[model samples]
Target: MNIAYLPIDERPCNTDYVRRIADSSAEVKLFLPPQEALGYKKLPADKEMIWKWITDVASEVEAIILSIDMLIYGGLLPSRIHYLRNTEATLWIERLRSLRKEHPGLLIYASNLIMRTPKYSSSDEEPDYYEEWGEHIFLRAYLQNKKQREHLKKDEELQLQNLIDTIPKKYIDDYEERRAFNSTINTSMLKLVKEGTLTFLAIPQDDSSEYGYTSIDQAKVMKGIEALRLHQHVQMYPGADEVGATLLARVYTQLKGKRPRIYPIWSSTLGPQLIPMYEDRPYQESLKAHIFAAGCQLAETATEADIILAYNTPGRVMQESWDQSDKDITYTSFRHLLTFVDQIKQFLNQGKQVIVADCAYANGGDKELITLLDEERLLDRLLSYKGWNTNCNSLGTTLCQGVLGLQGNKQKIIENIIYHIIDDYIYQAEVRMKMVEDFLPLHNLTYFNLKDKVALVNKERNKRVRDAYQLLIRHSFETITRLDVQTFAPWNRMFECGLILKCEQSEVSKKC
Candidate 1:
């Protein structure tokens, strides 16, 4: 299985993982187009140059993994050079269609642009239509239309909500519109797969950030993948550096028939507030208690935690107050975390598996955090800490890569990672029970079906679970193991003993 991977940019974790996986494969090549190079402030304006670069790379490989964002647009950075509509996916689709006509046996797996809320503001730094006259013109048109309405009041504020809502929500969510404007760029690649123009089509899971929204129902998109029968033997993971690594490793190993060395990098902060914005009263209260309990456990048994999830809370005054003249102590805490990164890198360099998930709660602080830690010579000690604003997406990617190296088959690897995830949940519950004794009964009494158990467990834990699970998952990736009695004995015995004792007391009271 000859493989070729084209990462969107250098900072992308997917490329890094793919590189590692390629090391274990017989024939795996990496092709990062010059226009899509990392840290390139702007892509080339010449459309022919871009097309030539993409075609040149695609021409060499039997299978290609292309980032739709990089291929159609330039990068996720909201800049004129990174614009997608102008560069266009239609050309790429045509090129791939031509390729399929030439070599129908070739495989192409491409990721679609799943809408995500854009964090970095291109308008803030660049003079664009949206900045110069787009908002103003829209506002003026809205006001003029309002004034012409005889029954309308003139006091209405010229707000974005009032103007943008004019465009119907259903229209925006329309499948045809999504495919045409965004999904088509990626789906067209898959069309090649369906028509036997390509062999395997892997569509990456896109987050809300791609659509310029805070959140999205990824399940809906996933349902579409299922409906199209694209889920069968298809390798799909959350598109992050680590996930790409894992998927590539699994695919490569399967093709090469050998185990590969796996290395994981973890970086993140934990001090961020539990509640960013309040939505539900009950949920907020529960979250606060859970965070406090988790914090107390972290501070007390920091060593027990595989990875520390830390972040600076928003509101500079509050952050300052939290620091409270303990700069040295705070610095020392971060240093200790960096020490773990260094150690993990050492293990990886020694040809052992290493996983790194750096948590950044308040966005855009990872660079400063990395700088501070590097001042202590910690960054040099690790293999990679390549991005800013680390999140769950990166963590999941790393786990996928690590698990992939350990497991040969893609679906089996996913199942194994999930199984370890279950064990991780039980471990955390045990920790929580130890920290807050009152919750022990609740934890023990909760009963979920197999499917519900997996879902519920996944929901409760954050990135830390990913870290710990990866450690154990590396051990069980290839083997089929049943849940031993030991996994449930502790909680089950506690519940059973409690129930029996209560029943005996009730009988004695009745006899008395």
Candidate 2:
């Protein structure tokens, strides 16, 4: 299968992950736009230019994974120059339709943008015009438009509701308008799916608030996709690593039939903290209990283990730290990870099985750091790693695609993906329990007297625990099963052959 991936330019995480996945499949051919053309300051002038480039290159490939966001926006919203860039989705739909006409047999899959609202802050500039205008109009009108309603004060809440009500009926009441906007892009891709020009459409499940829309039901989304008779896989994630890892683990268990011991090695405390944040209480606690129960046996300092799950969870520990001055201190953590890689190499030399499951953040300025690491022998020593490129960081999207490949049926793939998400939720519960256990002892209290404090703590802890659990759960479940195998199948087969040859060489050495 000749697979061509068109990712957003200069997205290191996405590029790295896709590369890892592609590496798994020797038959896969990756087609990424030049990195110099992918950032906010240096994006391509015309969307047509990028699309034309893809059209010219993709004509030769049998299967193509086209990221609409890349061809249109270049990257994520933060990297985009303006809100107008968001409107480029229309152009993409038009171009994709044209492509369908030209290459009807090519398997085309497109990823849609699901907006997610960032945490609100007074100081932060509102990125969306709809959000800013909605807030402004609502506040101004709510205070003056007394004839329509009364008893509502001019606070943020009243203003918000008033704004929601006054949002031009064309924008708010018109579900068709909203659906049309979505379908403008999705419909074109769906056409390809219907005509068997595209194999599937992968849509990332984003928070409703991001699009200034109400929350959508997972079932509803899946049902809509099924009506089209196209395979749909929901990208399930809590955040990044914790969720990513757990999801990969679950998939691996289902596919491989054996649960590999998951050794989570972190360079800092932030990596450890991620576990309780995202996953559900039962699964989180169970995993912790299992790891601790296995004790030293499961936790090997040496890299000779079957799998080396390494993550610098607090990718920017200093950025996350309370003190900005300490940012330099965080660099040590990454260096330490590199040191660990050296140790793993020694173990490989000793003929031990090893797989490095990497989840780390590379900042905007850290491109050279990553390049240097990749150039060093450290990168090749691992059996596999994620988030090394822009594509890989999109664990949710990659996993969803992989699920489609494994199940082959759209509905069943959606069901299994849902089941996997629920499983992560269960694990999240376990993590919450463990947090309670750890915090309770520190407070010298039990659950009996913990009413008021528990309420406050739970409120804050819930978000944290949810995030951590999701990061590990998602990454683990997705990587082990979907991304890794799809990306590395041929490489692994070749590696196994090389391993046999090495063993024979060792036997000869012994005899000599």
Candidate 3:
């Protein structure tokens, strides 16, 4: 019941979100490293401090979930930019071996990221050279890898040649050298899993695509898994921030000796077959992988299920959340939002726990879906709900919460749902871009950097979030008599913000 967790980074998604999910369970007591030891954005954590924290807590905890990215490279972003050689990386691997040797009975679960190569040019989370050649570097690898899988068109081949000729050789060398090293470490991790040093391992691909460096790296890791016969022991899927929470769900479910059965109902029939943004496979494929990875199973029927996942997805074409206002024709013609809501109601009336995965659009929630759920007054009754970032991100987090909510504290569960509605819906879907465009320009600020105006930005963001929540959530759920919201711009960027929620319901006060 006592588990020590080291997150992928200090981001709220990695740190605060896991804590909130764990708090939902009455049986779980989770301990995390001090905030200062986790480090800031782009700056690596103090590995020695984190190692000391892990060693100090090892004796008291029955289980420990670690982010190898944090342990070996200090943090997630740091993993992408680190200059570590194999000798140094191997030293950290040995450290893990020593920990396993020290605690022979410890139930260890670990997660490592397959470094992502973003298609766009931005150094916000990458090296300085990425500011110029990020897109080119990504394309070069993508084309090169694609050529091996299948023949490229003449135009594509010409473009690849041009890219190779234009980009400076040194940048490609720097980028690939780090990738080769990270891939080597990934292989070493499999050896640990094979030797029984780790009870389970998750290698999540961050910002992946079908043909690229990530796919190439995934092939190598998969080969290792096959060679070591770790199919039951390891899971490699498309995810990043949500892996920590997924592992926690696995630990909780396994400890309780309960494998929760989930039945998924999609809004659009074609939704599951079609892939969502920033992922490499179909939504259903990733959903199945995530279900098993979280220590749960798929139910053939709703009656036999512990939780019902009402997955709201696009009809035919998937788009970003911000573009929903423009409206896609397929979304209306191919999908039935009204029918999806009705099914959710039927399940609830049947006395089944229902959770909503509002992944109709990427990067945020679907307004139409949330509106339907709200009109039916189903917001406060669901076990869990999420719609944010990539489809897998939302799916993985919602699934984990759904599993935990089976026996979790009711107040905590309700508070967590409201927290996501405020965050995933009100802020991400509605307020973030509006604030960035209308509010930030008045102060002469940029979306990527708030500079000295972080407080000013937070003040405006918190007010807007509260106002949106009042309109969208509080009006429908009267049990929420009062709600106070405070938000922080972690890394001083508008892309993602951390929120603190204090709720006073008719029954109890839940601070999330």
Which candidate wins on TM-score?
Answer: 3
lDDT accuracy of residue 141 in candidate 1: 38
Question: Against the hidden true structure, what lDDT does model 1 obtain?
Answer: 0.37
Provide the overall lDDT of each model, using Cα atoms, as 2-decimal numbers.
Answer: 0.37, 0.39, 0.91
- Superposed Cα deviation of residue 335, candidate 2 (Å): 24
Q: Name every residue pair that clashes in candidate 3.
A: none
lDDT of 3 by residue, 58-124 (tens): 9999899999999999999999999998789879888899999999999899998999999999999
- CA error at residue 368 for candidate 3, angstroms: 0.9
Give the best candidate by lDDT.
3
Off by over 4 Å in 1: 1-3, 9-29, 34-47, 50-62, 74-91, 119-180, 186-190, 196-220, 232-251, 257-352, 360-387, 396-512
lDDT of 2 by residue, 1-512 (tens): 45556654433234544443443433344566555555532333345556666788777776566666566555544322233433566566567777877887765655554433332321122233444354443233334334234454457557667656765655333332443444344445555567655545444433222112212322344555677665433232222212222232233333344434444455444444433211222222323432222111244444434444443344334231112224555556434655555555555577544433223332111222223334454433344333321112323333323422232332323223222222122212233345457766675545334434554444444455345434433212221222210111111111000000001112111211
Give the higher-lDDT candidate: 1 or 3. Answer: 3
User: Distance from true position, residue 323, model 1, in Å?
Assistant: 9.8
What TM-score does prediction 3 earn? 0.98
Provide backbone clash counts, one per model: 39, 80, 0
C-alpha lDDT (0 to 100) for residue 379 of candidate 1: 30
Worst 10 residues of 2 by lDDT: 494-503
